[model samples]
Target: MQAWQGIDEFVSVVEQGSFTKAGQQLQVSTAHVSRSINALEKRLAVKLLHRSTRQVSTTATGQIYYQQCRQLLDGLLDANRTVNQLNTTPSGLIKITAPIYYGERIIAPLFNRLLQQYPDIELDLQLSNHNVELISEGFDLAIRLGSLADSSLMARRIGSRHFDVVASKSYFARCGQPHTIDELNQHNCLRGISDHWHFDVDGRRKDLRIHGSWRCNSGLAVARAAMDGIGIAQLPHYYTDNAVEDGRLMRVLEQHRPHSEGIWAVYPQNRHLSTKLRVVIDFLAAELGEQR
Candidate 1:
């Protein structure tokens, strides 16, 4: 008699293809299943099924009704599961990987706070420039910077970063500032890890191959060199913000600075994400989003 009555029995009958099978699935008698469908059809004012001794099948209207009922049932199950999961306490070891400098300066501190809040959680942090295989290496999460390559791994953008083309005040005074990307060829450009410098030329990303007397694999080393009047260098804001603010270094070619790129939290794809890992990612997104 209720509006919600008979939807389950009707859907089960259509899926099982017979009243007896539907009764077996729902743990009710075939007569009960038939009565429920009959009541449902009468309430809806439609002939919902074609009954025959060999098999039972839905009418055209019943087919449409079954589809809608199935979706509603699925949504109800999901809602119940979400409510149950809300009560689950996060407790587990989470393995994470990140680049060396950023990991130490940014991610490590945020995780330290997370551990303080959840004492049961444990962390295994790996700091390396090399991108490791997440699934094979057993990492639960990775903090990745800039543009990500095409990957099967899932990613969430936590924050953003932009490059700063900087030189020491003394270096700029002696060598002059590069007002345009082409002028970089004339100045002594310090190279870090790669000889290609990134910039924006007329609203398009441009990677300019640079020649420099100074080269270093460490960004900190390159930043220090630029501060000591070595040459101009391109580095992220974290590397140069303090120096630039304190008048130790100067930013040039502001018009050519590339658009800010994403800082991402990446993890392997899974059907169900665990509570601990989910908590960690949410914490990172909240903390880093504030910083930006």
Candidate 2:
């Protein structure tokens, strides 16, 4: 440990740009910080710093040394955290983000049950339709729906959902049920956030560019319009499932039903997850039904 004694102090001095700041951060005297770094340099037999009146900088060798030291320090921190987390229960303020509708309808209810079980765990959940930067925005987790694009964060599939091409039974009675993909263009389609609707043509996925008199960004609103006999709308299962079951809306284009997309819980890349995040994600994966 002798060689490691001043290693951290040296890293802090280089990173913090001054011995005084490093000492303040480490809660040691500036003199002690300087002495330890000087001792490390002597022990290593290398000049590690380029010191001036106003600033302290790393030498070329020091930069390489700093990189290695940083990895070692980070590894040590992660090891300590892992050991501590192992002994502890899932208790912490969990900050997360999810889509507005899903958060209100699904995540909120499921997390409420989790709160009932782990009363010590606190929640700071933000509901939004927009994508947020997890690390920069300080979110511990995110519940994202649909196929994810290439990203740096780690993701676990919790569930899946599909679009139900649906309309009111009355509307189907008047217009007649269209049986094929090309027939969709002949009908009045209620649009959602995207005018492009997705479908499964044979085994491959296809996007249907649609147009209509009734259009809205919210799936709930789009479903409501379909119920009111406005037009056929492709709505998410979560929004339309109850109505479909209750006979308020009739599912059309059963053969062209788009492939179910995955629901995911994403988090920052860490060596190991804290118990709170792990348990919640597991609960979601187990409790949230698949292949909707």
Candidate 3:
């Protein structure tokens, strides 16, 4: 094989830590990966990798080589992508994560349409409420809600996540409505996983601790409980919009409703942005930004 060919295999082995995994990444056999790396080392007359049974680490020389080669390889990928983007349609596998409710309600449908448009494209969708580390976990993108704190990751606001405090008409008729944030002290506020309710009070954000006879983790479940006149619940607009419009629920304390939270598409900053990542992020911004 050409000397230049093993650069990718060697880098993959270094990144993946095992010849087997490197081969899997490069779509080759472990024996082939081992032989190519050995050949590359033989040609260079240098020991690049310190290999052992459990894992592999780079030699001192190898570490420096890796840093330089990684940049070159990443640049080559970008150059290839630039050329291929003009010559071919966008197509690749994208691994993504999003909150379960929003993923099911919004993101899933948009991706369904995107898939129909580009049948060659593939997606591995992971939906959960927890924060995911994109780089360590090998995810291509993440759809995050609320404020962003991880400066190491890059983000783009795709849309807004508006929230409201709402209750069933019967519940309010029996208990009474709260006109201000302080009035919630006497009301049954069905809490989600978070005990603190957020609001914009006098141009500043406030976190008011709320309680009820009932509490759950799901916003959707809390919204349902409030619909049964159990108590008032704070929920994202996506959950309460249809109910409020149809009179199943009535919004209260609109003046105290916090500014709509940001819906963001986030990815690791250090990694090269591939064409697949570009298409997904651009698609999200265009498709969801219209909702703002």
User: Least lDDT summed over 10 consecutive residues: which range in candidate 3?
Assistant: 270-279
lDDT by residue for model 2 (237-257), tens: 998989989999999888888
Output the lDDT of residue 212, model 3: 86
Model 3 lDDT tens row, 24-76? 99999999999989988998899999999988999999999899889988888
Off by over 4 Å in 3: 1-87, 270-272
Model 1 reaches what TM-score against the true structure?
Answer: 0.80
Cα error, residue 212 of model 2, in Å, equals 1.2
Candidate 3 accuracy as TM-score: 0.70
RMSD of each: 3.3, 5.2, 9.1
Number of clashing residue pairs in every model?
0, 0, 0
RMSD from true fold, candidate 2: 5.2
Q: Rate the local accuracy (lDDT) of all candidates.
A: 0.91, 0.91, 0.89
Model 2: per-residue Cα lDDT at residue 102: 92
Error of 1 at 225 (Å): 3.5
